[model samples]
Target: MTDEMNNAQEWQARAESAEAALSRVQAEVDARLIRAELKAEALRAGMVDLDGLKLLDTEDLRLTEAGDVADAPALLARLKRAKPWLFGVAMSSSSAANPPRPEPPRTRHANDLSHEEWLAARAVLLRRR
Candidate 1:
């Protein structure tokens, strides 16, 4: 029937709209992440030496150019021998930057005192004044 055909077209339109919205949101997220990385890099400059050991991000550890993995073990051995934290700055910065996780939602219990009970408690304090 024509009615069924119209309903199918409407559903298809809605699906296309949803996909477009998702793409826009993903683009925005990518832009934000790029900005954060740039800011972090600027903050790290001058303080670390790129020649001796490539500065990563927050912590001090160098990485080999061949692969993404940090040359942490060699750096750690050096740190153990030097014990440079005594001076204030730790020599190397961490190569990996971790994104923050979203916070969990708060929970409420019905057995907990209702909103009316809170108002009553406030009233009792006002009466004493």
Candidate 2:
């Protein structure tokens, strides 16, 4: 009877320890899943950088049994709304209010320059040298 009692207690201790370890591992895995979900949603929302995720409040975030975040997309959307600079610039359907300025004209090369123009340019360049 004494031996049996001791054996039962030993088994109980071992089981408790195993349960504790399992819980720790499970929590770690859930945290990783949450992070992955957040990243996926942030990417879909056009986050400029993953670092911006750190700014989000994750205390309200919860994981579903399937390892998916319950409101990751919504959370990301809220974050985007609060911090527009954290995401990629949104394109407009209409053209820019100010049209792009035309590129400056190309510089005329010596070979393309008229004889008189070349002579004038040559004198200027020579003076600079």
Clashes of each: 6, 0
The Cα local distance difference test for each model comes to 0.52, 0.89
Winner by lDDT: 2
lDDT of 1 by residue, 1-129 (tens): 999999999999999999999999976665555444433443343223222233223243232354222544444345335543322355356747666789888664545758897677779979999
Best prediction by TM-score: 2
Worst 10 residues of 1 by lDDT: 46-55
